[model samples]
Target: MLKAERHAYLLQQLSKQGRLSAIDEAERLGISEDTLRRDLRELDMAGALQRVHGGAIPRPPVPASYADRRGDDRTRKVSLARVAASLVRDGQVFFLDGGTTALCIAESLPVNLRATVITNAPPIAAALIDHPGIDVYLAGGAVAKRSAVTVGTEATDFLRRFRADLGFIGVCALAADAGLTIPFAEEASTKRVMIEQARRVVALAGSDKLDIAYPYVVAPTTAITDLVTDHTATEERLAPYRLRGITIHRQR
Candidate 1:
């Protein structure tokens, strides 16, 4: 097949499967693995897909800013948020990562349920203002304007002071192989600290974020104890995470 046709075929496969194995696709296309690797490389250079160790996954969508992403897939975020909120115990201490979904999770918590929430996002802290039973601690640092989250050494160091019962990580992209990834470097650092300080890590991702990858990786799939996503996620797509011993919670 021509190079253009081959690229189209690969892209089509990615749309259907959300992931592509190099050897399998090469065999299917009646080409050598080396040739397929070259095709994947070209596609990666063109920003079509992200190539992983032995396969490729879709590139994560990058909205203009956090403000823009607030309205994108709002319902799905709420659904995942509800599932995440259900995991909270009344007296547990939780680390809330920054993102629109994290805000939803904060809002979804029961009014009278008492808990301590440490977060890097001011918006999430503000959302919990009326929750009289909940204690909110906003991390201090340089806030990234794009994500509206505090990042840097100061934020990460602040998180080290207390151990949390659960960490609700709002990931930009999640894949079995690539794990959890986000676009910015300093935010990734802050998230890493959150994961480290928590006993259990729960990732809140939308269906669109599944099987996709981004530039900066926060943690491997094994790092997360639970994954909460919308009902739109297929069982086939979630099988990998389940096999990794992550409890899956799908929105009803």
Candidate 2:
């Protein structure tokens, strides 16, 4: 392919997969690492991609803050939240992870549902505070300023005492190979503990998160019992998870 065509394809790959290592891109494109670096440099110069330590990610028009993320797909999240909330029985225990998607599920919880909620997110706790039937347990630890969630060794230790019926997780990326992952190492560690302590793992993710990989690995994809995502996700894209014995729920 021509350089321009190759560059365009690279951007498409990055958008679909979130990030790509230079060596992998080079191998995929049948080019040398130097050539891939040059391509990444050009894309970076044009503000088409962000060059991270050893990979490139697609550039957003404007930088997204943690608060900004909650508003990006309000309609989709609400629909997914409703489906997620419906999955909760009246008296089950749930662990809500620290992510905007989980926050939506926490807000959409039924007023009379009597589930016990264990969460590290301040927003999730605050959202459920007024619900008379639901009991909220806020895990204590170091607070993550960006997401307003408590996470650390202390929090993980606290969670070990109790097991939840369901663990709702969020992620920066997911791959069949890499599983669920977030950007920060500490957060990933806490999340791993959450997965281990819960009987079933349910991931609330958007289509954008599929097939993506981050620097840190939280759990393997096989760990998830169910995945809830926007309706735009293709059946082909979700087929692998089904093959892995994961139930996939798509929210319109």
Best by TM-score: 1
Question: Tens-digit lDDT track for model 1 on 75-190?
Answer: 87888888899999999999999899999999999988999999999999999998999999999999999998999999988988889999999888899998898777778888
| lDDT for each residue of candidate 2 in 59-125, tens digit (9 for 90 to 100) | 4333255788878888888898898888899999989998888888998988888999998888899
lDDT of 1: 0.91
Error of 2 at 55 (Å): 14
Residue-pair clashes per prediction, in order, are: 0, 0
The 10 consecutive residues of candidate 1 with the worst lDDT sum are: 55-64
Error of 2 at 39 (Å): 9.8
RMSD of each: 1.5, 4.3
Clashes by residue pair, model 2: none
